[model samples]
Target: MDFSLFAEEYFDEVLRLLRHLCTIPAPSGEEDERVRFCQEYLAELGIEATLDPAKNLLWTLGAPSQRVTLFMAHTDTVFPRATPLKLADDGTFLRCPGVGDDTANLAVMLACVRCIVEKKLPLHRTLLFAADSCEEGLGNLKGCRQIFADWGDRIDRSISLDCSYRGVYCRSVGSHRYQITAETEGGHSYFAFGNKSAILPLAEITCQIYEIEPPVVGNSKTTYNVGILSGGTSVNTIPQSATMLAEYRSDHRECLAEMETRFAQIFSRAKEACPRLTVERVGDRPCMGEVDPRALDELSHRAAGLIQKYTGICPEFRSGSTDCNIPHSLGIPAIAFGLYDGGGFHTTEEWLRKDSLKPGFCIGLEMILREGEAE
Candidate 1:
């Protein structure tokens, strides 16, 4: 379908909405303001959006039907509440902390909802619009898990607005995250020169963990990283506690299990070196190995066709761990697609190309319309 007229009329408005959204601090578990903004924004368009206990903002269109399709984008960012979401617009790019990842997609979701309402499109099935929270960091996909837990049976299919606009995620990459801590007696560095420090064991564990070389098989690979490490007080003091946050991701369930087993063994070996080492798993996202559902595959191909038609780029289908992981693991048909061209994910320099917004918005709009027609 031609999207020129729609883009001409709503492109600026969508960017404005996105700028407004980017300025709001909606770090996981603290998305009240963003959720409230979405509720009021949709309410002004005569759509009553509701906020669930999980802090997910949701709205529905058309009459209730057995074939329900959900379109979702996460509202949370890896950045904390104190991190500034400064928007820098130099006419070609909009730079912000989360402009590319979910914020851009979230804007696209809102834009599609608004467009559908404005066009007064004929709807044959239920269309559920969701802005879920807690998809990043320690939040552990709580919002999405809640979405499926509460409405899995009735929902026919779901889509996540995530990753890159250049591809569709057909497989879910599972992950296991943990917080490893080491505690010991604290003393002055001069006096404690011969005693064991918490930092020593943390460093040993991190080194041991990183020493592991992941095996890549077919489409799946096992990988690990230590993302954060913090400890110590004064420079002259031997700190009593040190902690590191580490995680492993793999498309194969067996690989994940094996990695966990290795991690346990590594921790056990580290404890012998420092007696007080402890490992606590904090996050787990299940992988749906190499999904090839015919219906969803058709949907993906249709989306890829639109991407090529509008942007001249052949969209790729790949695996990723996203909010769709929960539903996909539950045997519900789900996939993740991206919005906008950008980079610097999970960093302060995240940005989205200004030119990509319009096409991305159109792609999402069409994807939603097509998914709603699924049999």
Candidate 2:
């Protein structure tokens, strides 16, 4: 395909929409505004999009069928509502807090849907487009979980547009996130010199948790991290309570289990020592261990071929945790793709190449067409 000639019609429009979307503050739980924007955007394109009870923006093409291909990108960002968004362009790259992660991909998805509908593209299978919400931290893939729970049996394949750059995530990494707290008697530091402080056991548990060896199975890996910690009142006092938020993820179920057991042991030991420690499992993402490698290879090869045809960039195949994670757990075939070349993800200065928009959109459209074709 002649890349430039192919994307000429939609590239500029995608750019405009991408810039506009980056300005919308949509952190995890607070994605209504962006979802509404997406609905209106699709509505203006002659598509009447609807919202599920979870507020995911959705539309369907082709008649209802038992076989469906779901193409979705999340509307939420890791950045909070109060975070300042700086949409900048020097004619080469677009910079913002979430320019690459999903926002850029969401723009490409919307543009592709518009073009496909306007062009009256042929489709044998039902093609569903969704701008889902609650994909970031602590949202627990709520939107996707709902989707699969409701429509998993009928869907044949699922795809998520996330991160940046051309690649296919072939495996799903499952995870368990938790909040652990420790409490103890409170008193002035001078008077409570021998009393057990809440922070003491919490610190010990943190160290022990970090020291545990991550399990490995074949090429799969398991790792854990303590991302947040807080406690202690004042410098002059022995704090009564403290807490830490931690998580572990792996591509193998057995490894995940081992990590969980290790986590439980650590908590149990801490509680035995301090008698005021508790651990709560707050989030869980199931791992998919039985994905057919041959099938995944076929999808990856197909995606890479289309990307090369449209964008001239070679796509890589890898594994990741995304909305796809939930479906994959249910034995549904799912993969994730990126929109452009970008770095500094989850940071304030994330960006994607300005030139990447066209190819990215083209590739996404090609995949949708190829996937929706008659078998």
RMSD of 1: 2.7
| Candidate 2 off by > 4 Å | 1-4
What tens digits encode model 2's per-residue C-alpha lDDT throughout 155-226?
878888887656778788899999999889978899778788899888898899879989898988888999
Clashing pairs in 1: none
Instruction: Return the TM-score for each candidate structure.
Output: 0.89, 0.94
Residue-level lDDT of model 1, residues 169-275, one tens digit each, is 87778999989889999899997787778898888888888888786667677889999999988899998899999999998777787898889899888888887
Write down the worst ten-residue block by lDDT for model 2.
1-10
User: How high is the CA lDDT of each candidate model?
Assistant: 0.84, 0.84
Each candidate's clash count? 0, 1
